[model samples]
Target chain A: MMPLWVGPVARYMATGLVTTLALAVVSIAVSVVLGTLLGALLVLPSRAVRLAVRCYVEIWRGLPIIVTLFFIFFVLPVIGLRFDTFVAAAIGLCLWGSANVAEVVRGAVQSVPRGQADAAAALGFPWRQRMRYVVFPQAVRRAVPPLVGLVVNLTQQTSLATVIGVLDLLQASQRSIERLTLSSGATHAVPILGAVLVVYFVICLPLTSLSRRLERSLQRA
Target chain B: MTAVDFEPGFVFSHLGPLGQGLARTLAISAVGTAGALAVGGLLGAASALRIPVVRQVIGAYVEVFRNTPLLVQIFFLYFALPEAGVKLSAFTVGWLSLVLWGGAYNAENFRAGFEAVDPKYVEACRALGFSELASFRRVVLPLGTRTALPSVTNTLISVFKNSSFMIAIGYPELTDTAVDIVSVTFRAFEVFIAIGVVYLGLVWIFSLGAGLIERRFAIPGGH
Candidate 1:
């Protein structure tokens, strides 16, 4: 008997896996960059900018990822901002991911002792110089492990794209199961879903372990 | 596709069905939170006690659940388990997945809480002639629960938010109801905005309750 996943089914699932990875990479990249900027802005002296960024973070973080995905995928088009399924999913994921990343960034930056900034000021360093040379270097070190943890989270969250009709790994698996069941008159959901779970476990476990390890090492340092 | 029209009142017209959906979401979230706390509390206590085989099993369980997406787990229980001669309704799958996922994270939270219990307290119990189990019950449980409260609240709120995923399996929760309304009314913007506000309001309530409980049980001058 030919193996079920060895032929076209395998190829199809591989394509889906690539899409999942692409979505994750795009979301992570955009969120991390955008979130860092937002996080920096959150702590600025300007009350208006801080309030605006805080509201954005709180509102986005407060909602579920699926709701956000639906809003971007379905609601946005109605407002004359149409995107392809992939782009819509990516945008939704990025918005949520960045909100969370911003919190992590804000927390890390805030955790730096006030004395450090005060001392920098005493040295005649400007706000930009103090942040660049003193505060941010320390904040980046504190942020690395959580940021890594967020990568794992955002990667797993890419699964949400399947709900928005993206042909991600989970979606691919579901389609494969449907086709296989129809063709063979037997359900393959057991093995197929099992494979999807295992695939996610494999991809995420190392990152989870790495994040934990980084956290432990950082705590000691 | 037409003009930018905002109808904030659209959702109120469908409040009857939406209210029922909110009830279902709350029901599942409440039950899931309780069930997860029970499971996590037991596993956490067991691991803390260092039962060799059980600790290893719990470790593996936590890693597996925590590392994978909850959506995939829902699909697994919903689709794959039926092939194994076990069947569950969509609602069962919904809350069960939450229990499993939240339980795993809560296990870690509770374990950390238990570990954070001051060793000095355990010593005090022993000095008073308390047995290991007695000391654990009399001293560890209460203090550890206090420490665990914040993270537990976080997990519970997650359970509440995650109930939204049940929409995929057709459980007719809040998100599902909104989606249904949008499909029929073609009022995607209004429906989603209203739903988003409802969710934000619920989450706010959750955190507010958590704060109250935390303050109520806080040890005097304790961090």
Candidate 2:
């Protein structure tokens, strides 16, 4: 793929690609866990917890990821907290991902048939046990496709981390473009950004298609 | 490009500038979503009217937008297309890009709406000697509009959210302006929270407005 484009630029992109994946993978893990907790918190019987969770999800979803990234990158250091670029990128992506996941979780939980929960309760299954043992497993299955789609989105959102000087794929291309086209007249933007696009496409397309496949499979089931 | 250390008083002093960006954010999203709904409805209806050429053209356009990332689409409009001789402000590029991208998604919503219109109604109109346009206007459009609302609300919310990307190309929108302030002050948490609160407040207002409209329009005992 690098040879198909430009060797040196492609090589730089390949190296920078690691930073992107790190942001994506760590961000995804943290988000899913946070989302699950937030989702569960919202569905709790306590009105206060539910209200708080609902508010958190709503506020996060409405806000833009770019805005959040800026906040993460620029804000914390002023409050006597400083995280490096990678950590900031991870935290920013995590915060954004969690909100989307919470929505997916909420939808999936609702999608579970009413009878299953009722039946589980009738059989003397405790509420906590029922959710943990019965309802959640099924909801997770239903949630997978949308969750995948959310991840695909999250993957793209990670590109915004480049704005914080993270040196992810997009930032790498920006750097090379500055060097090649603008600065030295030796490097190029089209190939670099174009190459970044394909790398992104390669990373994202499979997950998106997989999400579709899962949806179809579930439909068939 | 100036990065600074975070401090307490920074966000308070800059809060005034940030509030102005929120107005721009709302304006861009509202105008863009409205434009998208209009274009999407027309395209969706045209595609479904059994006009082969029109259907093909609309279908292809939708496919192109739906498959690509919105950032690339925005970049193409803001940077690339201008080189092709059409110059537009960054804001115009932002608005038009969302309108195009969101409209494609909206078209699908409207297409589903069109399909959901009971064919029996169309047939009944035919029996009553209603013209095709009359039947569509009186019967089809109303039902389609109602059926399309909930789905389009999703797109509407998304249009608002994605409009933030307009900041990337220097659209002077709320998010972009916030980034500038945060970059200068390095007060990340406060500015982020401030932006989040503004967004939450707006979305709440939107949801409240949506509820009012839904209630006003809801059919008694209607799904």
Candidate 3:
């Protein structure tokens, strides 16, 4: 049979899980779109643009995600840019996630053989058509596995929103532990946090395995 | 509310605490890297040797740790373990989590390296009548470690970066130090930017050192 705390804790955590999913979904979607743009810009002929994109990617990716979130949530208000906790966390995550995805995209695009681009040029295709018809399709195949890995990482990282008090899965479990301990006078951290761990494991393990499988197949190809 | 003026130099005035925090971060990262290497090396070698149930156990360990976030693992170690009567200090929990997480990734890195060791070398060692242990120590160890160096270096850098997560449980690392200063001074921009630069510098130095070692130990005529 189930314990009394199970029902209440699950109910509380379900709401938190929804928030976590929303944050992850928004961050992932925005980052992928922005990062792909930054990545394409990284390969442009203009040295200044490439350098600017490089700095953005390096700076954001180098900082800890927590610091990024804190800077957004805590510091931005000092400069008159106020954001809600959820919005702040989402923006912070997008900055960091996009930087990582940008690197992956850059690497994937560069990995495509130079000969592919030259062949398209030889066929009298313009630069846009060459990249559109020839390069991106091949690059997309190479990029998929790493992109999936990034999604896994971004999902796991959404838990960090708890630090900024975003009521994520981890935060909800913390609240549950507190309420249960207060009422029952015994630590219920194990079951609640254990459930939290299981939740994350369930969400991430399949993606991780899928990424590995894709990587293996890519290597064989 | 009145406009909050940006004080870009505010963090510079509190260099003492930030320096202490830097030391703590470096110390924890150093110790964690060593522990991770030891644990990962052993587990990876065991997996390479294919020791019955041990291999499966190591596989499971790698998957579970890799699949979960480092933050949650830290919470489990800090918050959950105490319920089982295994109370540990926050500092203990900080580096322990890094070691555990980094060790898992490193195990996978080392296993791939060991598996990539060309079989002809093993055959050559065997034809010379060397025992399994000696051959592993002599030939496979050197070559495998070379192949593993790139990925292992990545995990090591991640260990340094992840030490920032210690702030959640208040371990007084660099991020924690910055947070404390921010609370008192309200100079979030300066504090976060300063610490971000520090972390980037640390990562840069680490990668540079790793690159040097990679060059020094590079296998002749092998990519």
Candidate 4:
């Protein structure tokens, strides 16, 4: 049988769930747009630009997400640029997600057959036109599977926002557990945490399976 | 901001402690990678063997670990495990969690590698009088390991990065050391940036090492 506070805890987690969803959506949107641009730039003619973008990607990817979260939430204030906890968490996730998305974009774009681009150029299409008409159509199809995988990853990563003091799902659960224990005089971490874990499993399991299925289908294609 | 505002000297001042932290990070990552590889190898083999129950279990593990945030897993072990009368040191818990998490991903990588081994080559091994286990150990493992190198490298880099999550449990790894220095010096920007650079350097070195291993294992014109 569930505890009396289960109802209250569910209510509490609902709010946290909302926060998590919002964080994931905002971060995913920002990263997708910026990362796509960065990915496009990665294949540009200028070696210097490509090198610089590569460095950016490596730096963001190399640092731990937690470190990046701390850098944004804690370090930025020193430079006189401060953001709220949610904003800081979003920026950190965006930076990390964008770097990964950029790599996916670069890989997908490059994977497009070279002949298509050459033919487009022969037809007097400019670089942008070639990407728009000839390259992206094929590249985007290839990009979808990995991008879906990355977005799923970003969704899961929204949990890290708790570290930055965001009242996301995990943080809300912790707070609820503290309150419930204090009021009801029972230690019930396992059940509550188990429930929380299951919630994550529900939210993410489908997406992960979808990602794998997509990857398999992409391979077949 | 002025040029002097971003001082490189801050990093130099904290080099001793940071170096110690970096060493710990390296130790954790190395041990974690070794543990992951061991577990991943077994799980990968199990999955590839297609024993229904074993495959289902490994599939569950891969999905769970791949789906959830590493932070939650760390928290569950660090906070929840004590309630069940298993009081592990923060370092031990962190190390084990890394192995558990990284192993799941590595298992998938290894499974893919194992499955990618050409059937013809495996048949040739059997025809050459190698037993099933012997064929797998001699033929499947080497080829699978080679095939899995790139994914394994990616997983290792992630394991190294995830090691920073040990800070949540108060373990004094590189990120934690950076946090400590910043609290002492109020120079969060400089200290954290320096730590980021350290991580970047470590990842670069790790990738280079993996590249060398991949080359060494390269199958004569068949990369």
Candidate 5:
């Protein structure tokens, strides 16, 4: 039979994966909506609004995600807005993800041919109509591959939530190893750690390859 | 919500250790970036040359590092290695992990740079009878490095930011110093903000330096 720790450890890791997935899903959703809006705002006619958005992106992008996590986890509590550790992690990831996604979104939108915009203008299309009919479709097509890549990054980053006590897969493995060591004599740490590594490797490796393939095919088109 | 009281003097008072911490952060970043560039340069060159085993090895390295969380990599180094009879200090493990991780990303960036070199240029070099190594050194490396500059700068900044993760493994870096101060004074806001300012300063300075290098090496009409 397999080692006794296998079943429980698998269950524990599964739970951790759930948390990781939930965190990524919620954060990605929030980031996509907010990022797309902020990206649109980056090209706004109003100088002050564009300036404010630029600073926001620069600050978040410049700071480490861990520091952002720490700030939200620790500082928000001081101001009477306490969040669960997972919630804090999600919010932190959201901030960093949105900043980066905003940049990607802006780049994608800007890369759409200016001629298209000029043609739309010459045809008397308003800004909203032009964005809806002429611009967003192409930008979204251009954005999908990079956006998927960003999600993969966010998935990897959810592991950082372990530092803030989120009991992620890494933390689960750490806890299992400690527990096994205490309960049974002379437990090896490698197998357990290797299992956790394999789990991450399995999830992430394919996504990255897929992203590269998409990028290549997009270039071809 | 009542506004948290504005506090400036706390961080100012602890500037000495924090300054030391900032220095350590910079040291790690500089050393890590250098190591990454060295490893990545070799791997990228090998890849561009289509070396048999090296390409596969680099592919594995890039995928593994890119896919996994840096925190787990750090932990495996810090925790697992000791069990395997390789005792490494938290600082050494932290530094090594950053170098390894940065190298993988750097390799991809460099490979992209290498691929960006036009085929016609290589053909022209061949027509001049320059040896492969000679032509690569004379033409490819400079062009690749220039093409790779922006991405490499971004990677360097990320490696520096990632040095903060070392705080989890007990490195006496800037974020750790800030955590220490916050614990003692219960002033999380001021402490983190102070450290953030230093981080911002470091990033800005490095960006300025990168911009200078970019200008110095910029080829006319080169992207």
Candidate 6:
């Protein structure tokens, strides 16, 4: 049987879908920049910088996403660090994605041939210019496929943001259930949840397939 | 509302009650991960057999699990399924949700592991007249397990961390405990910090164990 929650199903799905996309895009943008920098510094000549970055990534990655969400959402306000739900969620996700992305970036960057760095050095090119022209370009190319996969994962992680009342997709579904149950004493879980799943599939399928294809194409090349 | 006072013993005292929740979290995570391994392994094995029917079914399972968020899965199972004569205890829904969700992802890992095993080993085993089971156990497994170690560990870490989704379904895990403490004591910072610290400790311990496993099955970096 179709859900009675069908009344608000479209509205809930549309709201949740847009919120998910916003979270994914903002989180990805923040993390990619921070991750790239963190990764580069981790490979820097200075031991302390590498060690510090390593610790930061390790600390963030080791904690559960929910714990991070709670820490940012609840704890921040205690110390006078207030944020709206969106900002809090975005920061939590950015921190988590950055840790993983940094590792991915470092792995890709290190995979680039040492000879390229040697050639750059022989030409008296400064390190920044060489990394920009010679190294980062190749690393970035190799990193794109995996980074795409990371973004897909991050999209799913945004569901955690609802804990702090962001009213994202999951929350929207829950609200529909609550309202419907209260009004009619009947819940339309099937259609409501089914609709939510369909939305996610439509959003995620392309990215997932693209990454897989890129992995194959990259391997062949 | 006046922010509640940060009395010292009250927060610490709640730890006694909170231990039950923490234990539940650990148990749920362990059960969920074990269920994922079994379900994922079967699906992976079936899909890898190249049977069209099994492949199609497993593909759909993977799609449903992979595309949606775990929180939604838990909520659907916990809150919605009851109306359909598929009632579950909160704990049951929590564990089953993770099993269903994590199984899909882990199946992909297993399939990848199955694919990367050397063909020559299987050919040699076949030439020697070993049973398929024997060959899979002796040859394909050793190599595939090594290749799969890093990804498996990665999934394990995820399964452990994702355990916190139980909060949505009201399973009363660490995250929920932190919230409760914050509500009661108004020491949001301390409570949240404590929650993060505990999760970090647990995950660190898990990583240490995984690192040891990875080291045991060290392979060439080419893959």
lDDT of 3 by residue, A113-215 (tens): 9999999999999999998999999899899999999999999999999998999999999988888889988778888888888888999999988998998
What is the C-alpha lDDT profile of model 5 across A112-154, one tens digit per residue?
Answer: 9999999999999999999889998989989988998898888
Specify the CAPRI tier of model 6. medium
* C-alpha lDDT of candidate 6 relative to the true structure: 0.82
Among residues 3 or more apart in sequence or in different chains, the pairs in candidate 2 whose N, CA or C atoms overlap within 3 Å are A75-B187, A75-B188, A75-B189, A78-B6, A180-A187
Q: Could you give candidate 4's per-residue lDDT for residues A121-200 as a string of tens digits? A: 99999989999999999999899888988888899888888877899988988888788779876656677677677888
**Alpha-carbon runs more than 4 Å astray in model 2:** A1-5, A132-134, A183-206, A209-221, B1-16, B48-53, B82-86, B116-140, B187-190
Q: Comparing to the true complex, what docking class would candidate 5 get?
A: medium
- Report the number of backbone clashes for model 5: 0
Q: Comparing candidate 1 with candidate 6, which one achieves the higher TM-score?
A: 1
Q: Compose the digit string of candidate 4's lDDT tens values, residues B143-204.
A: 88888888988898889988998887788989988888887888878888888888888888
Using lDDT as the yardstick, the better of models 1 and 5 is: 1
Counted clashes in each candidate structure: 0, 5, 0, 0, 0, 0
Candidates in descending DockQ order: 1, 5, 3, 4, 6, 2
Q: Say which docking band candidate 3 falls in.
A: medium
Q: Give one digit per residue, the lDDT tens place, for model 6 in A1-221.
A: 85444656777767877887899899999999999889888778899999999999998888888788877887677767779999999999999999989999999999999999889989999999889899999888899999999988898888888888887887788788778889887777877877777777787889998999998898798
Lowest-lDDT window of 10 residues in candidate 3 chain A? A74-83
Q: Model 6 chain A: which ten-residue window has the lowest total lDDT?
A: A2-11
On TM-score, the stronger of 1 and 4 is: 1
The residue ranges of model 4 lying beyond 4 angstroms of the native Cα positions read A119-126, B1-4, B127-129
TM-score for each predicted model, relative to the true structure: 0.96, 0.83, 0.95, 0.94, 0.96, 0.92
Q: What local distance difference test score does each model get?
A: 0.91, 0.78, 0.91, 0.87, 0.87, 0.82
How displaced is residue B113 in candidate 1, in Å?
Answer: 1.6
Highest DockQ scorer? 1
Assess the local accuracy of residue A10 in candidate 2 as a C-alpha lDDT between 0 and 100. Answer: 68
lDDT of 1 by residue, B1-223 (tens): 4778888887789999999999999989988999999999999998887788999999999999999999999999999999999899998998899999999999998998888899999999999999989999888889998999898888889899999999878899999998888888888888888889999999999999999999999867887
DockQ comparisons of all candidates to the true complex: 0.79, 0.32, 0.73, 0.63, 0.73, 0.59
Residue A75, candidate 4: Cα error in Å is: 2.6
Q: What lDDT is reached at residue A95 by model 6? A: 96
List candidate 6 stretches off by more than 4 Å.
A1-7, A119-126, B1-11, B131-134, B219-223
